[model samples]
Target: MSIQNFLSNLDPRLQRMVLKNEQLEEEGLHTEAQKENLIPVIAKVTNIGKFQKITGVQKVTEITTAPDRSGQIVTAHIAANALPTVNKSPVVIQLQGAQPVKPLLKDTAREINLPSPQESSGNGGEGVIVGIVDHGCDFTYSSFRNTDGSTRLLALGIQEMMNDRTTSFQVYNSQQINKALGKPDPYKELQYPVDKYTHGTHVTDIAAGNGRNNKASGVATKADIIFVEPAYWDIPRGNLGNFGDSINFIEAVKFIFDQAGNRPCVVNISLGTNGGPHDGTTLVEQAFDGFVTDKPGRAIVIAASNSYADNIHTSGVVAQNGHIDLHWSIPTNDFTLNEVEIWYEGSDTFQIEVIDPQETTVCRVGLGELYHDGQIFASQEKSALNGDNVAMILCDVDREDMSTGKWTIRIHGSNVNNGKFHAWIERDNHTIGIQSIFAASRDNNYTIGSVSCGHKSIVVGSYDAKNLNTPISYFSSAGPTRDGRHKPEISAPGHGVLAAASLTGNGVTGMSGTSMAAPTVAGVVALILSEAKALGVNLDIDQIRTILERTARHNPPSQQGWDSRYGHGRVDAHAAVAAVRAMAEGRQPLPSAVTQEEKEALVRR
Candidate 1:
């Protein structure tokens, strides 16, 4: 029988036990389910015909009524009608259409397998410094407490140098002069107040907030943090831009690294402009690559931009001229056959192609015949150019007005009713693919970080370290770089991750983003470095990336080779630590640093 008919015949008591008063005998659900009149009903046991002949039960478990017609009910197996069910003795309650329960971490008695006791002293990032290139950190956070329950960050670098306090943390006038002179300010005071977004504090918590007092802590909980405020947002003015001009960023990156010295440090930038390398070359790259000395363990991490332009907004334009393809910003994914498309404008035809970032080619084409329909015709074929160049495809269309003039480009991952590709028509090109970072969902560009001034260093990605089946967040940006180089290098736990936040503030907020994911890898890096110190083996940034990538748990679901989405798959801190430990003991092959110089050179260039 159909569900409606079957429910209508069931006894009222049976219905209450199974369907939770889903449908009424007299008036039906809609008539009786008035908002205020609706009441939740607990399930009770009932009897059926021959089904009861097998098992015996006194009563059925209670089910709550839907609130205000906002619920549905169904039934399946319950305790036997003949068998006695003891109270609170793990009764097997069965219901139809119940969502499958995801096993909790606790349910699976998998030991929290950290490395050997000495390897996991929680001092992976000991002595190293990380700059929270964000708003500002709260020096008074309770997470900075020591074993004796005293706060360790009595004075932070930013708070000390910026504030008027007389402790050693104070930023003296000489330091202020150095900062003003474009030199490294060892005593630069914490400039922004604690309440400004609390971004720096939260980020600091992820990178190095010592896990104190059951507080949310980061991977490298004991590392030092330098707060750098690079973004200033004015809600009234709608100004959400970087602190200084591009030139200022060049100076800032260099200064941070200069102060880092011999210890390994990572400068984390969680911000970006709205375009590609051509439209915007992360201003810091100019200085970071130019002047900073290549210390053994120092590196930088920059956030991929969060800007996205659909039909309503477009930020980066992609076009081609002749054999050469030009892009204003990095496309969402590497140029595959999947991304290329050809269009017909009346009798003419034109094709769109995305080229490699490193190629230097020029386009030899211009605006042409206009077409009324979406199709554009191929007017002619020009000679192959030497470098990347983008030009408007010649098309036939009538338009004198540039303002509000629209064009369309077919796209994927949109809401197309049929199994057809969607198209976006906007005034400018959409930001192609900043959303493809390792663990970043499409919502915000939080977790992505560039290695240095250059875009080449490992931009870490996210994975559900605890749950293997969950898909990588839809927001995680994917990349092969614009040049098709495997990026993000690898992944880590970025979902529902526990980490520190401002102490004086809410102290903790459940956060999920690539931002949360990157630190897991960063923490592992700290562990590797820490182990290296003990073994007296010097390692470089490239070596660290290689070790992690080689030891990364291979995910078969990821695209062929290393995919843009998952990269090398989720990182295993324990596995990575083990690999590094084995290498230190000469039991396994050490990861090669072939990409190290290239990575550093990319930053410098």
Candidate 2:
């Protein structure tokens, strides 16, 4: 089917947006000079089976089945002439430019006093698979090898970007990866290289590394591993593109599920983005929730994000017919472009106006306006700005334009019932000359990033284990999601964690962040899964969460119950394992010593 035929079949509202996107592409709205990045649009088609039967359109690229069999997910290039056809589909979900999730990077797993592989009754995740979906991994690292020196990595899926701007997606069994490693350029033959970025290697080591050289062993030393490295292309002047999109994440998860077969798997995502609605409404978040649901022995762990100290989030409420001004301080010497997004309730409507430092009106967009000319934004960017019921402002401040200094955004309420909104500055790690600062605000709710905010995923916060009081890490993100759901459901030791280093074969290094903390939880979950498997019981996501929360070790003053800062509290692997054992034996688990009311009082104080 041609793009037009596919688009013609979509709902009228979707057809308008998709058509507008096509028009923008034809008009060269995304020219090189504009610096507007284009991303794939993921469509969830409920009647995919029906649509495929009538197929004459181009084959959908990067196709994956929705876990629940609800539909199919396919990626569409922004510049493609033909859009995929979904005739009379009940629902279609679209998202643009999910920012690349940066590594929240590490820790001493032993600090939490995890049980040793030999001491753990279930053979330390002997039958479970620990899937690390990050950058590439160092499959040659001895920590990933068996006693016979064979690789424990069951499979590897590599998503690479070719020079022609096409994707090179392939999956290889352990035998293929091992055979390729013997060649001069293993990556060329195997299609996936050893830990080029290093983050994946360290994370995998912490979760399932075998203790070599008498070093500290990971939580699930015997668990198999499945690694994914999504292909990414670097922009001419900026960092890599296509790194953080939801498509890659979903594809990675699908690959792991295929490889694991019947074995229980615990997937860890140490990377995250603060770009989307922190409420679990995005298509990617929903897909993740669907993937884990009803799939017993399957779970995903995500970092709570490292934006707590970044000061990029500002929140406020506007009264009826009232307006609020937000100041964003841009450093004087910075020259790179920046992005700002404002999210509000779906029922509320607001007008957004951006003013540069010199009081020039850069642009103004109303609630229902169509800013499709793309003079300053990509098609999806324009769609997100005008259609997603949010205000997305991109500031391209060059040194010559005097765009630096205090820029102001005025948000005027047009219709207000629930007038609250959360504004965030896009992460600028790769943009060398840009920095964003938002004026402090009173209502900074929903600071957690995407994927981590997923309702089904276990989001982990970080704490300093070296400190006697175990204070929450200053950089650990806090959250009661926009819709008011408690997040970072648990905290763990993330400060000064030592684990295997990717660059040196037998070397170890120390790193910190919620990234490191999440894998700690993932490793523990692996152990739990192993124990549960032995007991002949399959534990789902909710059961695992409850066991972890009940068995967690909290500080004296605030013992039981959930807190935004420390969910149920610091994770205790040994206690969690014991509790799982008790439950498996048909005996009641031990009760908490502290009462729920006391915990609430501590939170209030």
For lDDT, the strongest prediction is 2
Runs with alpha carbons beyond 4 Å of true place in candidate 1: 1-117, 120-122, 145-191, 231-247, 278-283, 286-293, 302-387, 390-456, 465-468, 503-506, 556-561, 590-605
lDDT of 1 by residue, 526-574 (tens): 6666666666667666666666776565543344246555666555556
Q: lDDT scores for all predictions?
A: 0.37, 0.67
The per-residue C-alpha lDDT of model 2 at residue 304 equals: 88
Error in Å for residue 66 of model 2: 6.7
Number of colliding residue pairs in each model: 65, 11
* Tens-digit lDDT string for candidate 2 (1-605): 11122332222223344544466566656545322333345556554454344333223444554545655556543333233333333343442333555577123565566765444567888889999887758777778877766778888777765433335567778898678757877666765545543888878888888776257777788799998876532222222223334566676776787678778999998887777667775666766777677478888898888888777888889999999999988776665556677878767878777777789866666654423232222111123212335666655555545667888888888889889888888676544525577855634446677667767888898888777788888888888786788797888878777777875767777878888888888989999999899888789888888777776766722755777867778887776776667777787555644344443332232
Highest-scoring model, TM-score:
2
